[model samples]
Target: MQSIKNGLVFIAVFIILATSCSKVEDTVIHHPKDPNTTYFPMAIGNYWIYHEFTLEPGGEVPTGKIDSTYIEKDTLINGNLYFVYKSSLSLQWEMIMRDSSSYLVNYLGEIFFHAKSIGDTIFREVNLNPLGDTIFAQYRIMHDGPDQIQLPAGVFSVLDATNVQLFPKAVSGPKERIMNNFYAKDVGLVFRNYFLYGKQHALKLARYHIEK
Candidate 1:
């Protein structure tokens, strides 16, 4: 009887261990595949505050300002759901959608950013002056790998996206425009540099909140 009880106990212990191991294996198998999605997290209540500065033409002296951007709510457009984006700097609201493939798309079907994309990806081309129609711009997004960037919100690994003028050629005087946006995993945008005409506008992350 003593030996039988010991054997039963051993079987019970083995069953418990097997169950635990199975659970661990399941967790590993179900782990998230696209971590890049965290680079541009989209959820209601997620917000970022920026310290904005504008530099004078051909100079590094910057006049500072502050602005914030946040996700207000979710709305359906064309049978697809998108988050409504708002900013303290502008009254205009934008509709943003994210797919499982890590692409951020606007309501107009424009690709804002692709987190997994490499090299140069042309997402938008627009005529700056529609009436003029001759002054055109091309917006490109790319991921040049990862780098460590430091800000008021601490240091984080970030991805980069750049936008530049393709037509009319970029010059030093007027009509020159270039923009760079940096995004951190699970943290959204951390820094931005927008140079237009002869002035430079920069934004650095001041603080942020991500609602999981």
Candidate 2:
């Protein structure tokens, strides 16, 4: 009886340990084997310059401008490492991102872009408010395929990832926002198009420097 009781206790302890380990494994976020293959490569000193333009109201005429984005540095946040990103553009000024094999995720684990196994419809939610209440933005991957694009920098083969934004119920504003980002392998974002409130804003890659 003593031996049997000891065996039973050992079995229970083994079960408990296995369950705890499974839970820990499920919570682990796996990093990619090769971060360079991601749509947006994150590394300090890598930079991209864009020729930004906005269509004139009720017309197709473009107001020529310029903008730039670069990886400033890397920092540890919430126990995870993320590359710091800065841009001269207004809409996306600063953000921290990391590659997670199939997706480029932000500090909150919200996907910034899907990198692999893309299907017809991939969706994610962005929290506009810190508490994740009241305000949110819905993003849907509208396209993922091969295409070619021309820009001031050069012409190249590219993979297109278009994201459409759906307005949140708590927000009172324009109902439509669409952003299209074209990324070339090795190089980062080559071109982008943003449409909102009857105006179209475009950013065409003018120059870039990617560190090996």
Candidate 3:
């Protein structure tokens, strides 16, 4: 009888250990970023604030414009749900969405965002509705692995979404522009470095919240 009781206790302990191990494994197996979005998180209530400035390369960067951007909410446009953001430009809206494979940035309703892995490249010429304005964008996945970046708010392990745009002189503001956007897992854009003509501007996150 004594030996049988000991055997039962051992089985019970083994079962408990197995259950604990399974739970740990489940945690490890879960994805790091939100399942719906990666480079740019589109959850409701997620927002980013930026300090826009103008700087000459290897020179002083005097603060110019202080810009703040945030996602207002999710709205269904033309039967498709899109995360809308506040913008100064007079367009339909600055929106973002996710498909099965990747995140898409709708610059005034244009599907211009692309690239997910290293060595990936996306090139497109998107047209702004009714204005006859055209935008040529070329993007290459410079880094898709683990990387750390420091912002005005904090440090982060970010996935970089780097791109360059060839804009017409009418819209390019007398120079071309490039953007190196840094995004954290589960968080939206945390940092961005914008280069136009002979000036550089940084958009650093002052604060952010990833909606649960």
Candidate 2 local lDDT, 1-212, one digit each (tens): 01111111000000000000011111111232232465576788878776655555443344555566777799998777889877544434577888766576778776656656455455666666666553646565735433445566665556656666655553555554556666776677776666534455666676676677
Better structure of 1 and 3 per lDDT: 1
Number of colliding residue pairs in each model: 1, 0, 0
Q: Quote each prediction's TM-score.
A: 0.69, 0.65, 0.59
lDDT of each: 0.57, 0.56, 0.48
Per-residue lDDT for 88 in model 2? Answer: 47
The residue-level lDDT of candidate 3 at 137 comes to 38
**Angstrom error at residue 197, model 3:** 7.6
Considering every candidate listed, which one attains the maximal lDDT? 1
Tens digits of per-residue lDDT for model 1 on 97-138?
655357777777777667677576848676766466556676
| Best-fitting candidate, scored by TM-score | 1
**Cα distance off (Å), candidate 3, residue 159:** 2.0
Candidate 3 per-residue lDDT over residues 1-212, each given as its tens digit: 01111111000000000000011110111124333456566775555655554444354354755455556667776667777665433244354554324746453443333335545554445546466655443443444523455555565666555565555635425334455655666556665565444455556565555567
Query: What local lDDT score does residue 13 receive in model 2, on the 0 to 100 scale?
Result: 7
